[model samples]
Target: MASKPGILTEWPWTRLGSFKYVVLAPWAIHSTYSYLVKDTTQRDLSNFLIFPMLLSRVLHNQIWISVSRYRTAKGNNRIVDKSIEFEQVDRETNWDDQIILSGLLFYLASMYLENGSHLPLWRTDAVIWTILLHTAVIHPFAEHIAYFALFSIPMLSTVFMKNISIISMAGYLTYIDLMNNMGHCNFEHIPKWLFSTFPPLKYLMYTPSYHSLHHTQFRTNYSLFMPFYDYVYGTMDKSSDSLYENSLTRKEEVPDVVHLTHLTTPESIYHLRIGFAHLASEPHKSKWYLWLMWPVTLWSMMVTWIYGRTFTAERNVFKHLKLQTWAIPKYNIQYYMKWQTESINRMIEGAILAASDKGVKVLSLGLLNQEEGLNSSGELFLRKHPQLKVKLVDGSSLAVAIVLNSIPKTSQVVLRGKLSKIACSIALALCQGGVKVYTMREDEHKKLKAMVSNEAGHNLILSQYGTPKIWLVGDGLSEDEQKKAPKGTLFIPFSKFPPKKDRKDCLYNSTPAMLTPKHLENVDSCENWLPRRVMSAWRIAGILHAMEEWNMHECGNMMFGIEKIWKASLENGFRPLTTSVDPKPN
Candidate 1:
């Protein structure tokens, strides 16, 4: 006697076994409605086809399974082997499965609508079936597709199949399947809003974030069509939204290490520690007041004093081709400020040590870690820790790359800061790219003009007379300076305050906080998640640039120079700020 085939071995075709009844039930109802109410002459012979289809479906599945097993034994079918391996890891219904499931439900609904018109009872049954099928099957399948494809497919299918009704439901199902496959292949172009839409469509349709939870640790989000089922059944996972947002915006291309520090203020730290204490004491049942309890605060403070040294949290390894992250923890913001250089250096050293220990290739500095000036350029850290082989990235190049990339090439870019080495480097790069560059810093203007004059003596007229759109880059613009900018002037903020609401047409926040997981998670709480997304894009671009160099030379030092770094940043996806001014004027 042979052993029975497990559900894992059967899959898609096996699904048909249970699903055939779903198809048959609708068909049976329609057949009865047609025979008794619609007309005696009109009989639904389609209902009888269910038994044969089921038998055929089983045979089809068994054949495929046998073939797959045979091919695996012979080692000639990599696709089947890979599918098996994938099943072991994921074990979830993929795009194809979703398509079949959605299609069956659509087909069932179409039958019900087509037959139930004559009887009031049958009409009610049709409505109930439609709701049940949508809630139980279509919604969950749509969600699965959304999470995997980032909400691109279902949105597209909805638009493409807008005119499709019960009469053309088959065509609609086919369109959805086609669009889903296409979206899965090219999901990067899908708009971010599709993923971040409020009241998340996980239950009604699908949401990337909601679906992402199903892929990750939580498996309770089992409702396919609408989250209502999950909520009603108490199977809804609360953290799905945050996890999904993190998946979309976080640097998934490069191996990223999150350098986290405690909140600076003693009061804040006390509160945070107390919160942690409460969480520990009550596990998932901790109350809000527990975080403010004096006993909890005292215990937290005592624990911090005893063993709050910088440490490494768990190395978060993502599944399905996602980046691996090592979360490096440090003291609060105020601790570094109070101790100054020594504390900062210790934190930097700890990050490096932890990263090196975990075999992390690149170490990303946390917020304000670049401040206090210890390893702002990573030159100091490299010099101090010669033995450590990890590359130190302050995320400045990536940040600058993102700002330049966001500004349209047609816009005239103004570098407003005093001509520091970094600013000069940026200005020079812009000039070389042939951007019509301007500057508020007179000294830097003179230097840039001289450099431009020296580089393009004859081409100077091109820059002088070009009709370039003006832009302003600074910490923040003064009220007087704000008046100087044209109505549509774009403001790119570096370190200074953000532009006033009415001051600029658009403001780009290139701050490091935009890229932090904490900020990305709180996207719903703010007016926009664009800044955080930009940060994430920049971080990914920088990491990719580093990855390419590291892969070739086993180190990212190749991008140490300003020119090399700038060029690599451009290649990694940041569009060049400067365009070749047509010396021959139009």
Candidate 2:
């Protein structure tokens, strides 16, 4: 919102929230139904085109947003180094409103225009001379006048030029929409050679840096799509060319650390930092509209498979260290497939090798990317490339510390789940700390007993009888087993993913995560299922390893000191969250 939001700042559908598009549903359905039902010769093409035109504009803008965000996060060829706060992102969310408004205005104007339904896209009618004359005379006035006056261009052009067509006006509006998104994309993509080769092109085309100056300076470079008028009136920014040149010459940044992760759900793609602005800023969940993009989701999966490379999901700076989050193209479901095991390991190995070659100090695996069943928690990567310098971490130690700290100071806690390294570590640590670890199954107890000492063995008792208030859980925690727990039992998860909330009566703690330090820059998006600005213990473990200049690998069977990591986290300004869980309606 603006300092004081008014009609200009807020949209008419502001109160509708996610269902704001419902306002356009009637028009869309009617147009789609009409177009399909009617014969080509009998169809009202102009009316039907309006709805699809709006959709095209939306798709066009979204392409710019996703590409711009992905490029900017990579920090290569970025125009403005200034951070785009959530306020800017939230404001940009409504860029579609202009598209909707333009379509509506075009439809209204078509009603009055001569032979509007049969207007050709372009005709070398005598209207060109009139358009040029009006642009030269009325353009400067419109630029200085109220912004709403800019809307008068299409109306004024059509009123004067009888030969002008709706399609031609529509084409002009599309040009405006394209230039608007491109100017604010915050990246330099236009080649400088074009302007040098044709000096006149400099006056005709405005670079991203040129418009960036108008936003920062607020008094220069006011031209909408052309720099010609701005130059004529002495409003062109002086630093525009310099910023453009420097932005183009900017070098690609090599991060100090990288976190390797993968997508969870089909909708998880939209939750990425480079995806939708509103969706990315919140905890990941299935949006009602995502089902409508089933085709896009499938297409994205295919594209990822074909691309066969990692992409930057997020980038951040903590103190002097540059951190990046790179995601493998595979999804959680694909990782569980036997057919995908070799392919998945190959990608992980490639990423590790690339990070080592780039002089990255640490690279951490997240989500199913580090599963023991898949790669023995990243153990396979080391066997293939033992001489790599980049320290690979599974982040299990910090995750263990966070889960341990989240548990209340109870004498006994129920431990249940499929046996994993994290779960085993938590059970043994609790036992060694004199906390009784009760197990329900004999097999799990025997497996855990083999991993612990005789002194701590007594603390690990086989009994599911008591109503333990604290339950240390992991994957394979079924709803029926959850029902067995007493009401008000606090379930603390030791895994990367949270369990399904089956018992409302039972309290569920989120997967291990901690509040990020204030100095962590560019933290606009939440990690999957974690609260806003809260970093998962596993993700933070890699960052800590990099910052501490640790020269050891924490992946595979290797481990770090739990207390050392926990103490370093606090010392480095990373605070603990009291509780983490999937956000639910009150």
Candidate 3:
């Protein structure tokens, strides 16, 4: 809300007509770009002009207004009208459109810069450095802020489809030209080529794919330069179907700060739960001290808000951050699966109990260690009942192992696919022996959902034995991770879990779940426990001596740092590596 005099509030179209006053863009940019490619006599001035215009627009009121709207919505002014129904649109367009715009803008701006002509060695070097710094530091930060502001408005589109052809066409053409200019013909680092490749692309602008999802689904996809934007802002801002369609409509009012909600689809909720857990693990001040740290708190909050808002405002900011250029080669989904599974084991039984309405069989994969079962005691109780059957699989293949262990003593099995296929081979062998076919994995639930929409019959093929239901049987794993389990699988996450018994269930069952040599060491080693006291004595002596040296100069607030160090020493279980005061000669 800017209250400009003579503004047309009721008639939107009357205000839109004001765009006619905008001067036509200069023709020199196109001429320069065309002339550079076709004629050597023409100076390469495309980048020098284009980049400035884009930057200028960023400084303009329209962009700032968009940024303010985003901040207001994300901050204290956000309103949620649950009655507003919107169709599912691809939010991914936010990323796609941003990259396209940045590419055009960057080239135009670069042309106007001094880099357009060859000069003396030192002068040329200075110009190149200037361009690099401008492209990297100034451009990425500014773009990230602006784009965040623009995308913060969570408006769902009437059309559910994406303009992929436009995106793909623009992406390939622009990226190829960009890659060529960066001095590399391919996607690798080589000499001067290394700087110009993917990293620069990501540093300069986001890829089209990233923003397209934002447009398609407005609420969840707010980040500009990095996916880290949402994490920093305390919002689970990522691409999701619910945010694009049903999320805002179902909720009656928008929150000042995004509230933790169980119904925020599966992915967003998982991020919140797991992220909060991680935050809890980190060292933080007591509630009272934290509340007292008003300046620091305000600074942190403002930074998050500004960072998130910038990305939403400037769609091309993602490209400027070099998100598209850098390749995360080893982003394995399976690695995450294994990690989550292990963490879940700490409270598996409880998760199972939470998920099941009646006693049910649990076919645990690998080893169902005692601690894991104990952590998930509710599931354990259900297992003890006569109606429930608990199975354990100890096979090489994870999928095969979990299934084999879960099957009841006697059950019929069906087999499909060729004999050579792993699923088929295991199914046939197990079927002959009257064992039911089953699939197992951390993502079993997600697979089941995808199975629903797949018209190719592949989904039905996987679901022949039915989707595996997951009672997390543990508190550590996130709801999203649980949901991602095979489709038709049920998630028994601790938070927002269905009620059981009269007492409320604990969100985290942190009852000394893991027992190993580490736990034994904790109990047996007096030396480990004594180190904190020894360290505290040393720290106190050191501070006393330092204060004396400074003649009481360090007395005010200086002791706080030492106090923090002392507390950290105790919390981390610090200990001396050697038993002796001094090492003996070897």
Best by lDDT: 2
lDDT of each: 0.41, 0.81, 0.28
Tens-digit lDDT track for model 1 on 1-586? 1298554444355446424335445554555566557555454433333334444443343334333332222222121111222122133323135434443543353355443122221223333333333332333243344443433343233324332223232232333443333222211222457646854544455443454455454466665435667777777788755544544454322234343333332333322211222121121222445444667456656675556565322122212211232222334444345555666567567766766775556665544455524454455666666777555655555544445554554524656643433344455556667765665545556676676556632222312221333443544345665556555455555431234545645334333223323212211111112221233322343354444544321112222344455466445444433222222111
Estimate the TM-score of every prediction: 0.40, 0.93, 0.19
Which runs in model 3 stand beyond 4 Å of their true positions? 1-78, 81-92, 112-377, 380-586
lDDT (Cα, tens digit) per residue for candidate 3, span 179-246:
22222111111223343464544333433333344444556435543444444454443443233233
lDDT of 2 by residue, 58-135 (tens): 888889989998998888889876765566666667767666666655566555655555454556652464346335
The TM-score measured for candidate 2 stands at 0.93
lDDT of 3 at 154: 16
> After aligning candidate 1 to the native by TM-score, how far in Å is the CA of 181 from where it should be?
39
Q: Residue 581 lDDT in model 2?
A: 42
Task: Give the candidate order by descending TM-score.
Answer: 2, 1, 3
Model number with the top TM-score = 2
Q: After superposing candidate 2 on the true structure, give the runs of residues whose Cα lies further than 4 Å from its correct spot.
A: 1-4, 29-43, 112-118, 126-148, 580-586
TM-score of 3: 0.19
Q: Each model's RMSD to truth, in Å?
A: 20.7, 3.4, 27.6
